[model samples]
Target: MNTLQKWLGPVLFCTCLGGGLTLGWSATTDLNKKRSSEVAVLQNALYDQECGSCHFAYQPGWLPARSWDKIMTGLKDHFGENATLAAEPQRQLTDWLRVHAADHAQGGKIQKMVRSIPAQATPIRITEIPYFQKEHRKLPLRTWKENPQVRSLSHCATCHPQAKEGSFDEHAVRIPNFGPWKD
Candidate 1:
């Protein structure tokens, strides 16, 4: 074969491979950006009223189904408080939470949270998750205890102003007394 004929095949192959790689990389980058932005917002009125009344109505994507199941069943002693609900509403909320728990949730943030948990662990408190601990590890214990506005780490919305909307982006965080977090 002539030099041009022999070179043509390799040139076309390289061009196709480069183009395919670029497209794949672009799609992956977009997906990751979307996933890192936020989680699904809380939509159920019952969940908001019942859970939000006491504490932040955490988005179901924060925990796994097994964790939700355990929490829902033990409402009488929910974090040292009696949050027992009626049978019908309890069942409904349990089902809803199970369907949207981190294990079954969409987005990379939710998946990342799930991955941080051990396989045998069923964490009832979102604060108990390894991902949650790691994220807040930099904060001093005094931040949670001394800050009256943020009495506990469980109070996510206290610092995360957009937490109710399911956005936990660090840039948007505004600690009660500490101001915006840099890390």
Candidate 2:
């Protein structure tokens, strides 16, 4: 084939692939939103308990089923904080958490999170995502004045409504009374 024909075929293939990927991400985000809704319902049932109070599960599927198992068993010393959960309650939650943990290979939430994480020596928490940092980086000092809901950095869903959808695009974020985003 001529040079023009060869280039045209390859370019068209790439263009189609790129478009497909973008569409896939959009669909996946929608799925995440739906799944997040279920998890949120589960969260509400645990009103007496505050598992997600300090920490976050931006990508709940990031850890393996076994990881949540380990954490559930040691609630008192949970990663340092006292995440102590009662025995019966823990059993219920442990099963629920494991069920939602990421299991897929390509678009699995847990796999995506693990890949995004740096291979640094330090341990990492899901709350420390770059998007999370960018959103809350300027709030440490001012966080005190905010309402109780927005006080914690884990409340990404409060400001960014699409957070549960995995839409961390800064342009799509709405930071409370701050209005639309600058970035």
Clashes of each: 0, 4
Candidate 1 lDDT by residue in tens digits, 1-183: 699999999999999999999999999997657656568775799998988887888888888999999999999998899999999999999999999888865556787789899999998888888988898999886677678888889888888888887878889888887898887
TM-score of 2: 0.48
Quantify all predictions' global Cα lDDT against the true fold. 0.86, 0.57
Error of 2 at 41 (Å): 8.4
Instruction: Put down candidate 2 lDDT per residue, 53-170, tens digits, no spaces.
Output: 5644444454555556666776778667776767777777778767765444344333455455455422234465443344456654453246554665556677667665555555
The number of the candidate with the highest TM-score is 1
Q: RMSD in angstroms, all models? A: 7.8, 10.9
The 10 consecutive residues of candidate 1 with the worst lDDT sum are 30-39
Candidate 1 clashing pairs, residues 3+ apart or interchain: none
Residue 150 error, candidate 1, Å: 1.0
